[model samples]
Target: MRKLLASVFVVAMMIGCPAAHAVQPDEVMEDAAKEARARDLSRELRCMVCQNQSIDDSDAPLARDLRLLVRERIAGGDSDSQVIDFLVARYGEFVLLKPRFTLHTLLLWLLPPLALIGGGLALWFYSRRRSKAGSATDPSHLTEEEEVRLERLLAAETSDKQA
Candidate 1:
């Protein structure tokens, strides 16, 4: 039984580790430094065809093309920043996996915290309102008129029982 469990665990791990790279072997640079730079840039770039995935992790044709483009730029002796700038100029800021902070992105950064504070305030108000409503219906807080009516009913019941 232990052997079977071990085999199943190994198979599960194998299945979980799917092949992640889309870069073809031919696109690799001869220089180790250039290849490393290309790989780093690929991880920073968004795959246009697979919007949420980095180009390095995507299997789409566009991702492969972008990977090759990055390698070509590295081989042509462009500095890392220059290669990134060139790609950004061509693809716009959306191609970056993490966009830079700017006036236009201020709302994007502020919205989450604002929403959390607003939700917290709403919950506080709702709980306070619920507490007030609950107190109004509690037996211990009955009005004087209701207490007199209750007492009369109890007295009538006691006299009927005696008779």
Candidate 2:
């Protein structure tokens, strides 16, 4: 079973031919500095369409285009901050993987804990009331005469059983 699993993994690894690996002559980075800058910026940028993935790891066409744009901007002498600022301006703060702490975002972050605590309190109160209700004595209180009658009936049943 281990050998079979290993062979399957090796086969899967060898199957897909990645386009990035077969780069054209023109696509090659002419300068080491620009290449480093591109790598640095790509890591910082999140893929807008694929909200979970970094722009560097995403293989979507839009991610590829954004990567190309980052490379072009870096090659044109834009600083890392400038490239990031440009993207933020174009896509709004949603492009960032980490949402900034603001009033609206703060509420979003706090909602779950607030709801959990509120729900727990409500449940506690409800169950406590229910338990109290369950344990309550009968609404109609038995008079002393009724209580004496009940005891007599119980005693009669026991005496009859021993006969």
State the lDDT of candidate 1 residue by residue for 1-163, as single tens digits: 9999999999888766433436768888888988988989998999999889888888888988899989888888899889889998999989999876788888887898999999999999999999999999997998999999989999999999999
Best by TM-score: 1
For candidate 2, the TM-score is 0.53
Clashes of each: 0, 0
Error of 1 at 97 (Å): 2.0
TM-score of each: 0.70, 0.53
Q: Model 2 scores what on Cα lDDT?
A: 0.76
Write down the lDDT of every candidate, Cα atoms only: 0.88, 0.76
CA error at residue 106 for candidate 1, angstroms = 1.9
Per-residue accuracy of model 2 over 1-163 as CA lDDT, tens digit each? 9999999998777665343432234544689888778766776677887777767767667777778888888888888878888888988877766666788689877888999999999999999999788766543466789888988999999999999
Clashing pairs in 2: none
Quality of model 1 by C-alpha lDDT: 0.88
Off by over 4 Å in 2: 1-5, 10-28, 100-163
